[model samples]
Target: MVNLLLENGDLVVIEQSDFQQLLDVLAERTYQVVGPTIRDSAIIYDEMTSYTKLPIGWTDVQGKGTYRLKRREDDALFGYTVGPHSWKKYLHPPVSYLWRTNTTADGFQVTTAIEEPPKLAFIGVRACELQAIAAQDQVFLQGRFVDADYKARRENIFVVAVNCVQAGGTCFCASLKTGPKATSGFDLALTEVLTGTNHYFLVEIGSSAGADVMQAVTHQPASPAQIEAAEALVEATTQQMGRTLEPLDLKELLYNSYEHPQWDELGERCLGCGSCTMVCPTCFCTTTHDTIDVTGETTAHSKKWDSCFTMTFSYIHGGNVRTPLRSRYRQWLMHKFATWLDQFGRSGCVGCGRCITWCPAYIDITEEIRAIQESTNKQEEKIGGKL
Candidate 1:
């Protein structure tokens, strides 16, 4: 396979034909091949035994309030945008057992939990997802208390990233400056190139492990023309993004917008159902609860995903801190765009737009931001006139 390093120091690529062979080899090594596939009319990640399991000849159309699948004339793998699932399900897990308690002669004893490591090869990873992974890393790994469970799964994963050839209507990664092309945190990267008479992939290797995979595949050296073609594809996709966020100073803007009236308007339509947080790739909040069987002999404690929209999320000693729907909406938006920067040195949003697509009431974050900005500007103009 043509082995060229891209601008990112941690990704590699292989030709389409050779890529199939690489997958077979990785499978033999016992690494579970997880990639996108067509299921229930949408592209979702599942166990892939071979290249046939990939979502070939399929693409998706995504918007602020809609999503649908379309068939492509040519067979191409990794041609779709991000779906409802993310790598977090595998790494963080929706539910996990912290520990168990048992009755002992003297008292109750708590037993430590044991987790097995699974070798994972994640295929067709997008640029926004890479950033999402990085954001979770901060929450679970780099914090004061590192999550042992998350750390183990993350350490065992091998990422195969794909540069977006087409952007979803709901995507705003370009505005967040997180995607359209993978810049880091990948072992390999690929750009699928399709022309009138040819279909192939331009591959680049980012890590030693990725180079080892390339050694197993048969490929030819990429020419200058192919490299140029790859660059042009990325540029076109970047320009095709359907949603855009303004270039205001995000942190200052959101912090100053706490009292904005748009929050109340959005709250009226919001169901407070928390679907957006569930679909979001970067949301990492969770809550814990205990359960007992009917026999009363068995008990278990579990941690499940949680959202800021829930009143319990903001529970103080006596009552919830943010009581009104407007306050809850304001809290979620401000934390994502402003406070997240202060905490992680980056915005919590990767611009995947799941927040817009999956919301039951179709609350569009981009439109909300614009409305707030306009209202704030008008208020400022009136104040200046009075002065």
Candidate 2:
């Protein structure tokens, strides 16, 4: 354990073994430690009682509509990119029961559901994910009508963020300015450094709670060389980006692109399967359902995840608002990149690229945005020609 208080922040150089002890410390604090684990051949976050539960030597290869897990020659707990699941599933559950009701003759009794937000320690959270969580905080907490359940769940969770030492083929956090290194919104952050035969983690404390946790873990001040190694690791990951999303005026671009022919093209390619929204780390669309019992005495009112890709999402009394595939596709893309700004004061996307990786039809948001830009440029050229 080597700990140092640098000018930038508090830094600690801990061996691989001590990293496991950090998990134990969190467990002792009664935090249900959830982190990356190899399950069904993919790195998924779940309850991890021991460091062994982590995908120690596993990484992932991700591309448009493609994902595969591969083994690294060395042990690295969080070598992979964002998986099919996100922290959203835990805080804002995929399926949640809001309340139930029981009818008596012509009257009804309503029962409110109780929420038990767990004290959770989220390990191996990437920088892009941290940004996504921040974006969602605006949705669930800062919104006019706060989601009580999500707020409770979010308030109790402790985040241990991980700096990306490697980026997936579909990742574009560099362009989003959200990754390679975690700047804030974490209790602690870690950068994995594999130095020849030795592998270690550079731990950084971000909050007072994190400083408290450090008391339980074995750690020592990081040397200058180790600090340099950590910086280099982040730098290398930044340089190895597999994709890039240009930070254009996406709001204006998408707003003007409503009539672009590309929407029709995307409609043809899109399967309306809702894979993008399902895998997105920040998408928060949901629908409520009420089920009546066979006896007509009891009913269950539930809330579940919804997607703009589905026709049912825009359905109203008269008809489905977005009947055409192009309209549905346009609604999703426009809302994600355009109207979200008006609603949330920020774009909905955090540029994790999970939507691209998990989409059954290789639909890439970056590619689509670029297409919109090209179309805009072409339209400008035509107008200039007439002038």
Best by TM-score: 2
Worst 10 residues of 1 by lDDT: 5-14
Q: 1-387, model 2: which lDDT tens digit per residue?
A: 434433335888778877888989999999999998888988888998898998888889999989999888887777788899999989888998889999877899899874688899999899988888999899889968888888889989888999998888988888878887899989889998886777788989888788888767888788999999899889999988889887678788777778988988998999999988888888889999998999989999999999988888988999999999999988888877899899988778877889999999888989999878887888899999999
TM-score of each: 0.94, 0.95
Model 1: lDDT of residue 351: 89
Candidate 2: where is the Cα deviation over 4 Å? 1-8, 104-106, 381-387
* Model 1: residue 276 alpha-carbon error in angstroms: 0.7
All candidates: CA RMSD (Å): 2.4, 2.1
Q: Write the per-residue lDDT of candidate 1 for residues 1-387, one digit (tens) a residue.
A: 344533434223355666678688778767899989878887888888888888888888887667788998888787789988888888888888777666667876776553786889999889999999999999999979999888989999888888999889899889888888988888778889887866777777777777676666676666788878988998998998889887468678788877777888977988888888888888998998777667665457778899999988999899999888788888888888899989988888898888888777878999998887778788889999999
